[model samples]
Target chain A: MRPFLYERADQPEAAVIAARIQGQQQAPPTAAAAQFIAGGTTILDLMKLDVMQPQTLVNVGKLPGTIEMSDQGLRLGASVKMAEAAENEIVKRDFPVIAQALQLAASQQIRNMASLGGNVLQRTRCPYFRDVSYSACNKRNPGSGCSALDGHNRNLAILGTSDKCIASYPGDFAQALIALDAQVETLGPNGGRSLAFADLHKEPGDTPNIETQLQPGELISAFVVPTGAWTRRSLYLKIRDRESYEFALASAAIALDMDGQTVRGSRIALGGVATRPWRAREAEETINGQTLNDETARGAAEAAFRGAKVYSHNAFKVELGRRTLARALLDAGRMEI
Target chain B: MGFSMSQSEKPGGLNRRSFLTATAMGATLPVIQQARAQQAESAPADPRAPVDVKLRINGRDQSLRLDARTTLLDTLREHVGLTGSKKGCDQGQCGACTVLVDGTRVLSCLTLAVMAQGSEITTIEGLASSDGALHPMQQAFIDHDAFQCGYCTPGQIMSAVACVNEGHAGTNDDIREYMSGNLCRCAAYPNIVAAINQAKNEMRKA
Candidate 1:
């Protein structure tokens, strides 16, 4: 609850420019720094936990002309609420899986306030990391000992985890986007550029804080999903400890194109059990040229968790992940093309 | 910002309809003591700093700037003089603190007042008509008898409004799933479902 200055930008460029100016204005070793505010759900939550300390918050929610929808696909403003994006006619009709994922990801209230961009960028909800006094989260403080590596880590990562960090990417929407091969548009100091959605998240290797590939002073403007036959045949399956308002213990997003009864091409991504929105390339390859059946689906599912490594408390995730992926693929296969 | 509810607005002056309506809504709120009593005999010590907050409840932007640590639950009752929203767990586990931000329902205890600004917020107080007409949902709650102790009523009503708006009240199971976030200690879930069903039917009529 530290005091901080606030400014609402009228334009996206102005917000970016203001952020850059604020970053430059801060003298070395000074406390006066600015952070971009979008949705304010995750950032504020972290701030309350003393995980982030910024002197200024540049309000980017009111930035003009960021949301748009066209023949290209839905272009959601970075600040567009997750609930709105999930329920958008174009998204729900063209990509019901994405809609279902968002619907089941968070509670209705959180979905209402959380933005599409915010959902993609939400940090891990690791309890130890949020509680800074615990002194065991590499993501919160790099090079520090990871308490979760040995402690209660039932919700921690099972894939792409390192001895340094085992936190998972706790985003439901990102898995769907990765499955659809969405593109992310960002406006940085050097102007605008587009990146493959799947490439946005970096591996947890050493620096878990540097989670995404976006450069400093960069603002995500919109995310676009390209039109394809697979777009209409997508499904998101999340398995959590509870029925609602819970993060996935193991989730999968699947999009497939079928030729009669045979699988043509498919995109698969795993969530809650991986460090990133994991695209299951092995599973996709295994399912290709094969008909939709329990055996083939189970083989692809097995391929999805081929090299999954287990931690002290997360050994259950490997089996849960395999089953979740198998169920998602079979569900997608049942959809009418 | 200059608006405030009249200090003379007495909780006792509430009409029979209003009283029954509030009770109907309050009936949905959780009486935590009862819940704990039923759960078991085991007990454990709890340790957490209490944060104080002064929210601008309803139209009156009252400021009781508290311990930067008070929750919205303690803030409304202790500072802003509004007690419609109940505190079930003080944790985000229950949806008893559900209130509307602009038009969307949120767990107020989890939200800080400083974050809510320039948005036309509404609570159970603002959900009714100025002349004391009960909101359709309130009437529906009474008709459906959606509560037992009435502690969780306000939150249930608030979330019910949101559910209809979000189109999540389509079926009985849908209402049950969406309303799962709010827990009624009285185990009056059947009545709550009936209330939501009645409210959806009323909304459809409108």
Candidate 2:
């Protein structure tokens, strides 16, 4: 790891100011300056791999760590540990998909230490992305071309991909957040603001280097998920090579508000098969106002992967992704309340 | 246990205003006297300066002046001479460097020594009782033959203890899921699960 300045920030505003100051020191805005470190799971791992090199790190763990629930919905502070959020009684009862996604991610030890904000912003697990030796990664180096395009693309993205990058978003919780129409609250040098969870991550269209919409000094303050009739029925289904401690090969988050076997409303999202957290709006539209039988579930699943573009090595992901969605939908439909 | 920064008041009673003033001066001054004085004299010439870190390891307060790049794993094995925690991948991928920070299991290899300041850290060496009796988890691992090469034993034991404490050792599947972070290339997973279960029962009794 490279030598860097470490500054602990006890207050949220102070952390943002420190980051803004560090960012100004760098000549170019693109230069990696100050990064916020909460759990140190992603940042430290990338630093060790030499993939990410931030000159300064502002410790933002002291900002807040609350998981508040109210009539409106649940508000999860960014600093809350993944394990704490996953095991919270309100989270499990109100948003089973969120709990399941967090529980299914990484391992118990990692979940204990990783913060919710860091988890959502975690980088792709593409071997080429992690290994700096691959200089052709456009995400790592813009206009350098993507090695994973023809390289071992078995685990790469099949949807929301471009010629520039195909690294799949290897996270589970973000999928649930997007499905439930969650909102992200952020505090930065410019002050506080809220944005839809869908706007957090960017597609690898031209600038795969620019991953998130967050500015240099922006710190995710909290995530607010509005309560819905479908929230209780939501669930996340993950399919991986191993039953535990592994990234998903394909996963699905599904929530449905049903009226006597007919879908009154539906929200669907797919993971491990897309460039970003992908909300399957088309799939939801296909199933809404329709009965959630095997046929309808299969139709929705097919619709979810309709735009998937598979390479030679990842053609199986398209079918596997569809099956994951179908299975998740069926399982969520069978949930009692 | 008194290594917490929250417990230690600044000697000069510097408040937020004075701290901010010091930071501004440090940034502007080519050679800040106070900043230079705080750096470790033994630190090698490098762009990164050494930072003073205090940690409560095994219920004992310890202090070390280390470079900003030094990881908790390296600080323990190299500086503090507590080599019980093994570094498998030197990344967060492997749990060989697992340690309990403030009663929560975390990867010490990914954790910087400075970040662990003012936290209660429990390593493999701290697992046994003061009387030298083996920890229940350690005893169960021995009984179940949970390891072959023994390189990953310390981490496995630490994680197993945490898994039980976290109440994830109720059944075989739960144990396996919770203990998945600690991997043993010797393929001793079955034995590891058995050891964790046995230890859970023993600890419950105690």
Candidate 3:
């Protein structure tokens, strides 16, 4: 890790102001000179790999770290640890999908240390992007060639590829958040604003380096997952090489509001198969007002991976992703909620 | 300062990386070797300056100045002279660097020492009583033979203690899921689970 100055901000406004006093910032917030350190999991990990070299770290862990659940929705403070939210009784009872996603994402140790704000903004697990020795990661270098295109891309994204990059968005909580239509609230020097969770991550188009829609000094303050008809019936299904502690190969976040045997409204987000926390709206549309059967579930799965582009080694992901979603839909259809 | 190390920094037109790349196994070793040499040449080059941090460890308080880049694991093993917490993989993938901050288990390798100023950190060295009686988790590990080489023992023990306290050791499957972060290369997982099972009951009584 490079030598850097660390300052703790007692408040949100102070932290934003401290970050705006940059040293060597880039156009993207990921490469900014000053970064806000909440849990310091992703930032520190990348720094040790020499992938991120921020000159100043403004600790904003003191930002409103609370979890409030009411009839309105689940209001999760950005600085709340993953374990806290995962173990919350209300989240477990009302939003099993959210709790399960958080629980199954990382180890118990990581969950205790990592903050919700930092977890959503976690980077890709692409070896090419992580290992600095590889010179051809478009995500790490703006115009450089993509190494994963020709390298080991079994874990790369297929849903949101733009010929510029294929790195998968390695996260679980974001999938649940997007499926639930969560709203992200952020604090910046200019004040604060709220945006849809889907708008938070940018697809790796020509600019893989610019990962998030967040401004240079903006800090995510909370994630508000509103109560909906589909909230109670939601669940996340992740398929990985192992049973635990591994990134997903293909995962499905499903929230289905059923009218007896027919689907009323549904939200589907695909993880470990896309460049961002992907909302499979086409897949959701295929099942809405339609009977929840094996045929309908299979059709939704087909619609989910309609845009997937497979590489030399990752061709298994498409079929695997399809099967994963089909199984999740069928299983969720049988849920006793 | 944008990721200063790259393939182009190979010193000349014909470098070892290029040679290895032509042979199909090109990278990763040379950079690690180069970094090791850099460390040997100027150990602890505190160019960025140090920050004052007072840490409460076990039951004692220690005031010290550390480079802001120094991790809690490094602070424990180097400055505080507590080598029980090992550094197997400094990047938080391995659990050899696990410790308890504010009675909750965390990867010390990923946590900056300065960030731990206000928290009470407990390492393997702090597990034993002043009268030399080992912690229940430590005793259970010995009884169950939960280690072979024991490189990951300290972190495993620390994590196991937290697992019980966190109510995550309810079942064998739950124990396996919760302890997934800590890797034992010796395949002593079954034994570790047994140890945790034994300790969890003892822990509940206390």
Candidate 4:
């Protein structure tokens, strides 16, 4: 890893100022100038792989780390460690999907150090993108052809695939946030702004280089999840090669608002099968006002994977993802809460 | 001459004009300026220079001058001589470098030493009492024969201690789920879980 200047920010404004100072030196500003360091799990891993090179790092771990719960719902600070949020009593009670997503995402040690904000912004685990020796990853180097398109792409995305990139967004918590309609609060040079969690990640379009809508020097301060009828009846179902400490092959975060047996409303998000955190609104609409049973669950699952594109080795993901959603929906529907 | 004396005697000492006058008389002002320029050009870029970091490890404060990229794992093994925490996979995939920061288990391989500035770090070396008595978790590992190759013992023990403290070791499955981070290639998982359970029971009894 290359040596870089390190600055600790005592406040959110100071961190943004330091980032703005470094942002001026680089044109078409990206995260490479002065990246905010929180948890240091993803950034350090990329730095060691030579995939990311930042000239300066602004440490934002010292910023306020709070986990507030109220009638408005849970407000998780950006710096709150993943494990803390996963294990919080309020989070587990009100937002089981959020807690389960965090718990099942990474190893125990990683969850202990990784912050909520950092977890959502973690880069894809595409081998081509991670190993810099490959010169064809467009996400790593813009305009380069994606090697995964023709190479080992069994784990590549099936949805939101452009000709430019096929790397899957390897995160679980973001799916839960999208399913629950969480809002991301960010502080930047222009001041504070709130955006839907669904807008956090962008599809790998021709400009796969620009991943997020966040401007340079913007620091995510907190994630506010509003109270909802479906919050308590939500579950995150992950299927992977191993039982734990592995990225999902295909996962589903499902929440159902049931009036007796009929579904009043539903929220569904799929992970490990798409280029971005994927919300299946069409699937949700299919199951709305209908009773959740084997037939209905299967129909909704099929609707979820309606536009899925397949490769040689990843055709299994479409079926696996459908089953995952079906099982999660049925499981969540059966909950007595 | 009066002006020179007064300039030299100024409280601030060595005014730029006086220094230039002294160097001019010595007839090496141009050479000195050229040397200064060379030094400036040869100096490392500011961002690449090593930074001083202070870490509280094993109940002692140790200060180190390290590159900004130095990880806590490297700082402990290479600089502080605490080699008990192994670096199996430098990436966060494996938990061989697990240590306690403020009593919470974290991966030292991914943790920059500078980020641990104000936190209390407890490594495998600090597990035993100063009188040479083993910690309950350490003794449990021995009693249960939890390890064979022993490369992942330190991390497993640290995580087990934390798991028990966090009340995640209530059952066999809970131990397996929570302790999934530490992987033992020797496949000593059953014994490891037994050790953690024993340790948790002993601590509860105490």
Candidate 5:
């Protein structure tokens, strides 16, 4: 609990205004500076573990227009609780995959307090970053050598990973959003802008510390998922080490549009095995116009894992990833949509 | 001769210590009775800090003050003193902190007190009547003997309410998956399942 100023913003613009003022008046937080607080689920948990030490926590839960839903799809304010979005009648009925992904994620208690925007921005659950006494993490302290690259890379990413970092984005809701082609809306010093949910995450190349495209002093306002008839035909499949409350080893989110027995188009993204939301367009393209079968499924699965490069301890993830994709595809296809 | 000696004898037998003891007991009875009545009549202590909040809980207006970082679970337990909502794993992994905020079962540990300030919060304590009656879910737990150590019973009951509220309690598999957030380390799955079924029966009958 470092001493710092605290302010609550009532409107979205007011939130931006507050951040701008803090950045201007205060010295830049150097491992001891200011940081905006959302649900406090991820940040506070890390703070308790001493993994994150923010001097200032700008409370943004009271900002308006953060939670809303309409015919244009869902508009979740940065403060909207994960439990609220997951249980929205429209979300559950229209986007069952997203609902299921959220519900099956953390326990009911976490989902209740965690927000959709916070879920998207949650840091990697890489064991190295969480253990603070070991300060060899680039994400925790930029330019610090990553101990996870060679040591305990079991839960590390294979795709979009670099020598600087091998941390995986450990969010179930983000995977579902990536598969659904959702967009993230943000408010900053300049104003508001939209970002494709896929592009929201940056590759951990060299600068593993810079995780998202969000600029300094900018706050995520909402995440909107585009409406599609195939939305109801999507599925998120996660395979973890245990039955509950565990991060995934290899997970897949699949959205399918079928014409009779043949596939029309599909959206696929892999989680738990990638540095970002690992979208498999190559695999998706290979499956379109193709009839559903074990052979085609296996081929698409191979395409999904084509560029995967595993470390010493995580070579098993490539095969597991392929199986996860295959199974998710089959599951989506079996849906009687 | 006996009557003449009685006046002096009686006067001498009446000791100062005995007279004082009797007098003290007579004087303390009213004070003791008033203390007991006050103890029984005193309202449950308000645990919430004095922050103006108007939230809905179990379809009723709830007004209270709360700490900024106090988790919804803590607020329900300490502030509102709704102890039916148990705190097992405050880290949100254990479903022991489950409660319904606006009809959806959520983990209360992860939620902030201020965030749920205006939301409809339903805790396990509010599930039953204020007159010492048990909610059907509670009765189901008792009838089925769903809990062993009973530490996770409130969480189990809260999840059961949410399972039905979400309509995911239609089948055994659905109930298992929907109630998956709750964990009873005592391995009370069979009894939990029976309790859920009994609750469904009771709910349908209602």
Candidate 6:
């Protein structure tokens, strides 16, 4: 682990003071010399492996850790731990997709320590990016090259991949947030602002090193997920080699507003098969106003993966991802809401 | 008893160091191998300035100066002399470094010592009573033979206790799912589930 300076955060505005820069749009938040640390799960783990080496860390422990629900929707403070939000009564009852995504992620101890804010920002688990000994990662070392392109590409992304990087967005909760149309509130050196969750993550597009749209000093403050007719009917389904404590091989987050046996509306997001929390607008369009059935669900699933590009090892993901989405739709359709 | 070889491979005589290179001996890309190669010729990133950290462990406050790189697990083992918490995987992948921070289970390996200033940490050694009585979960593990080569037992026990407290141990399936964080290489999973079930009832009674 690299030695660095640590300062407890005084205020949101003050926290970013050290992190503020002139124009760092080209650099990822992980590349910032001074970064925010709350749960320290991602930053600490990567630092020990020498993946991320920030010169200074501003502890965000002083931020409010809260999960509150109202008539509008659910509001989760950035500091709320994954375990706390996963087991929150309102989240489990009103938004099963959010609850399931949090529950299925990481492990008991990791969920307890990791913050919901940081959970979405977790980097890919691409083996080449993790082990610095490889030295051929576009994300780790920009323009060095991508080893996963040819070597062990089983877990890489298919939906969002440039020739430079194929690292999949390794998060489930972000899929739920994107599907539910959550809005993220952020505090930066300039002040506070809100952005749609869908716009938060950037595609690899040649610059795999710059991951998020967040500025050098910006920090995620809260996530507000608006409730609707589909909120009670939503579910997140994850498929993996192991039942628990493992990253997703393929996953789906689905929310449907049903009109008896027909679908009134649909919201779909995919995971483990994309570069970011990918919104399957095509699948949602296919399912909306259509009668909910096995055949229709399969059609929507096929639409979801129509644009998938597969390499040598990860070609199975296109099929597996389709099945996972279809299964989520069928299961969610049959849900007793 | 901390040797890498687990002669008994049973309840009482499980060696903690069974978590070392013994099980991973012929594996490709072992973490230790990468760590060894990195240590010999890794990139220069060390600033190595000691920071003063005061931590409350098992109801006692201890103060020490440590590098910013020192994790809570290292502080407990090397600085404060609490070796009950093992470092199975120094990274957060394995839960062998599990401990309770402010009564909630967390991976000590991922928590930096300086950052854990205010929270009270409870490790495996703190589970026993002052009168020498073991925690119900510990007793239950012994009665159910929940471990063999008990390297991951501390983390498992800590996680199981938290699982029950968190009301995630309502059924056998719940126990299995919630306790999946702590990996037992000996595959003593069934026994661990039975132990958690037993202790859940006993803990409720107490």
Local accuracy by lDDT, each model: 0.74, 0.85, 0.85, 0.86, 0.73, 0.84
Ranking by DockQ: 2, 4, 6, 3, 5, 1
Fnat: each model in turn: 0.12, 0.44, 0.43, 0.48, 0.20, 0.51
Candidate 2 C-alpha lDDT tens digits along A1-337: 8877777776676666556655544232224577888888888989888888877777877556799986658999999999999999999998999999999999887898789999999999998988999899988887899999899999989999999999999999999999999999998766899999999999989988878888877889999999999999999999998888999999999999999899999999999999999999999999999998999999999999999899869999989999999989989899999
> For all candidates, what are the clash counts?
16, 0, 0, 0, 7, 0
Candidate 5: RMSD to truth:
18.6
- How well docked is model 4, in DockQ terms? 0.23
Q: Once superposed on the true structure, which residue ranges of model 2 sit more than 4 Å away at CA?
A: A25-31, B1-47
lDDT of 3 by residue, A236-336 (tens): 99999999999999999999898998999999999999999999999999989999999999999999999889997899999999999999888888888
lDDT per residue as tens, model 5, B53-127: 566776777677544456677777887767878888786667887888777777787666655656788877678
TM-score computed on alpha carbons, candidate 6? 0.90
Where does candidate 4 chain A have its weakest 10-residue lDDT segment?
Answer: A23-32
- What DockQ, on C-alphas, does every prediction get? 0.08, 0.29, 0.21, 0.23, 0.08, 0.21
Tens-digit lDDT string for candidate 6 (B81-147): 9999999989898799999999999999999887787779999999999999999999999999999
Stretches of candidate 3 off by over 4 Å are A23-26, A70-72, B1-47
Candidate 2's C-alpha lDDT? 0.85
Evaluated with TM-score, which candidate comes out highest? 2
TM-score of each: 0.82, 0.92, 0.91, 0.91, 0.78, 0.90
Residue A235 accuracy (lDDT) in model 6: 99
- Tell me the tens digit of each residue's lDDT in model 4 across A153-260: 899899999989989999999999999999999987678999999998899889777788888778999999988899999999999999999999999998889999
Which of 2 and 4 is ahead in DockQ?
2
Interface RMSD of each: 20.1, 9.5, 15.2, 14.2, 23.8, 19.0
The regions of model 6 sitting more than 4 angstroms off are: A21-26, A70-72, B1-47
The C-alpha stretches of model 4 lying farther than 4 A from their native spots are: A25-31, B1-45
Winner by DockQ: 2
